[model samples]
Target chain A: MILIEGKDITLGYEGQGIISGLSFSVEDGDYLCIVGENGSGKSTFVKTVLGLVEPLKGTISYRGGLKKNEIGYLPQQSGIQRDFPSSVLEVVLSGCLNRRKRLFGYTADEKKKALLELERLGMNRERNASFQELSGGQQQRVLLARALMATEKLIFLDEPVTGLDPKTSSELYEIVDELNRGGITIMMVTHDIHPALNDARTILHLSQGRYFFGSKEEYFRSDLGRMFMKEAGHDHH
Target chain B: MIITEILSYPFLVRALLVGILVSVSASLLGVSLVLRRFSMIGDGLSHVGFGALGVAAFLSLPPMAVTVPVVIAAAVVLLHLSSRRKGGGDSAIALISSSALAIGVIAVSAAGVNTDLNAFLFGSILSVSRSDAVVSLLISAVTLFSYSVFYHQIYATTFDPAFATATGIKTERYTALLSLLTALVIVVGMRILGSLLISSLIIFPSAVAMKLGKSYLSVSLIAAAESLIAFVLGFVSSYVFSLPTGASIVLVHLIIFALSVCLRHSIIVFRSHREMI
Candidate 1:
């Protein structure tokens, strides 16, 4: 049931390695939350898996009949990307672009699916609203809906709740948890590690030069885990 | 009757035809360029086209043919420079634009083509030959067709290039294709809008449309319509007032852009007032 496997991957940009010798495997229906301090290359790892960046070393393979394009991805939004001129519906529908084989346009079914995903994200009312005009939480939800249109099998979310209030962040996590419960594999990199670790079956704690990849309980007992928990202040809330 | 008499002139008819066609193409592609903050690229490529036109005139060769490939080459170079370095887009554009303009000025002086230079820089719509009109029509058609066929991909890339690439779109190829098409459009369009003002045709309509339209598709359509209206009005006004055609078209776009901004502000104010009531 291994959906994706990465071994000794050294992810980086422009011939320089950011995080080296990182190995991880994502199983079908598994919720893996990647946690780390800043500059631990959490986003880099996500990009490598999504094929946006190649590993400077090692291998990444997709099993379980998963195509690279079939893996939905929600990238971390920059300020410029947030101000992109597009509507909520158009943004979501564009996710289906990778799924298409033809060059004409989105099919009726694709449009319906995009609409449905918007509704599912509780954004149907804002479907025609400009994406730039949306609040941070709403923008993340729209992006999630876009990822949904890309694939139902697996999703990779990079700090989906980076700039939201605590309440909105928890609500976003609830949606992600629901997605996991519905049999989708999730690999999310998050700064809010406590809630993520609570819902995640697997915890990946990446630090400089090394990483820990195991079940949640095993992660709690590791030295890196103790350090992280201490730094994150051991409150399981 | 006077309008019909004016339209009866072959040169004027050709100018209008080519002008409208170029406007539509420029506006459609403008949305993508402006949204991506690469609007100045059109200006840069047009300058390159101006330089190529000067070189062609110096050599007694066909200007459009030389201009098209030269602008395309410049586009490719700019694309490469921008991609190779971070925050290089504007710098690359500035470098190419200034260099091209300098080369053009020198070429015009060296070849004593000041009259031809003025026509290319400011645009003499009355000078649009039959052959030039045919080429302009064909290039405009290709630009529009390419935009139509790759509309979705362009949309994805323009909105978020990294996400588009992650979703298995060949973003680089599509971006390069867009640059080439923009180059072609600018080269052909320089005949009507002039190199100095051609980028305005690509920048103004899109900027104006974004203020009024809610989505990319709607904005593109609005931009094209705005470009057409501006072009026709500008052409007519220039004919009546005996003004420079290219500057006249750009002036019309500026007025329309101002109007769109006012209209958008008025709607917001009206909605807020109603809410207060």
Candidate 2:
């Protein structure tokens, strides 16, 4: 049932260690939310696990029939995407690329599946619309549909709601909640931990020198949890 | 009449052939380059090509033999630099381009091949040799074939490389492939279209086409068609007016780009008007 296991991973950029000796694992069908401060190596840990960056010192093994390509990934927007001229349909269909074996074009079945994903995400009306012109929440939905095209087994989201109104983010959260309930294992890196507490069963709190990987109940009882929750309270004012 | 004119002049015929091929390939690659905010890469690569031309002239080697490999290496080096900074390459481009230009100016001056130097700077569209045309054709064919075969991979890589890499696409390789082909096109385009006009062929058509088209495919298709038109018109005008070939083509592109700006604005306004109703 273990999907990803990182043992004593030293996470950082270059050779400079930011967060060291961080060991964690995600079970199949578990909602794991990684939360930390801005410089807490949260994104770096996600990158390390995804093999985008190598751990300065540990091995991350993928198990439970979960290949790297099979894990749907929703990365943060790099802003350059705003300049891209892509239709929503085309954007979502690109999710099927990892599943694609041939080099030519998307299959008719793939197109149909992309549409189905759009329909399921309540974005069918915007299929022909320009991706850049879409609202932030709508774009995330389109991106999520693309991610789903990769696999239904597991999904990795890095800072999925960095820039969004609360109501829109919550609506987006509800969709993620639904996916987690449907037995898709979700590993999301988040700055907005308050909303994640709603659905994330396990908390992976990456920090300066250590990381916390435990259930929500245990996290709420910990020192780091209380501090973050207090910080979350201060942000509302 | 234009056909007759083209037939009468061997240079015009050769220019037409090489110009069309280069324009088509340049514009096709330009869509992705512009979208990725790599518009300056063409300019950078062309300068590198110019520098390679100087080195070739200095060594008395066939220009393609030296220029092709050197420019390709520069293209890969540029790719590496750009990817390293992640959305950088503007400064890198400016630095590399200026350095290459200076080196080219010095090397070409030292080589003392005055006539060849002029041809390289302003383009020798009228002087495209048989071998040059053949090389252009082969490079264009390779560029087109790679675009066709790796269409999906290129699309994925351009749109979102992080997602593409996660989905197991070798984004680095494909992007490098794009840059390598672009190097080839720029090198060939430099020889025929002239270094001055080559950047315009890569930048202008795509800018205009992007305004009219909503999807990458539509934009790319529009860019290629628009480039072909610009090259032909520019070619004919250059002949009739006895103006420079590269200058005339660039002017034609400028005119169409201006019209596209106005037309695109009107289309947006008109579409919104219809929506309002």
Top candidate when judged by DockQ against the true structure: 1
Tens digits of per-residue lDDT for model 2, B1-277? 8779677877678778888988999998988888777778889888988888887777778888888898899888887787676656788888998898888878888888453777778887877888888888999999988988887789889999889988888988898889989999999899766775689989998999988888877887899999999999998898888888888899999999999999988988999999999
Candidate 2, number of clashes: 1
Model 2 chain B lowest lDDT segment of ten: B113-122
lDDT of 1: 0.87
TM-scores of the candidates are 0.96, 0.95
Q: How many pairs collide in each candidate, listed in order?
A: 0, 1
For B1-277, candidate 1 gives per-residue lDDT tens digits of 6579778988888888898999999999899888877788888898888888877877778787788889889888877776664867787789888888888888777888344778879877788888888888998999989999999999998887778888899999999988988998898888877789899999999999989998888899999999999999998988889888899889999999999999999999999999999
Q: What tens-digit string does per-residue lDDT give for candidate 2 at A1-237?
A: 999898888888999999777788899989999999889898788777777888899888999988867789999976337868888988898898877867788889999999988998899999999898899999999999999999888889988887889999999999998988888999998988665568889998877787788999999877788788888883332
Put down candidate 1 lDDT per residue, A73-125, tens digits, no spaces: 88888723655668899999999898687779788899999999998889999
What TM-score describes the B chain of model 2? 0.95
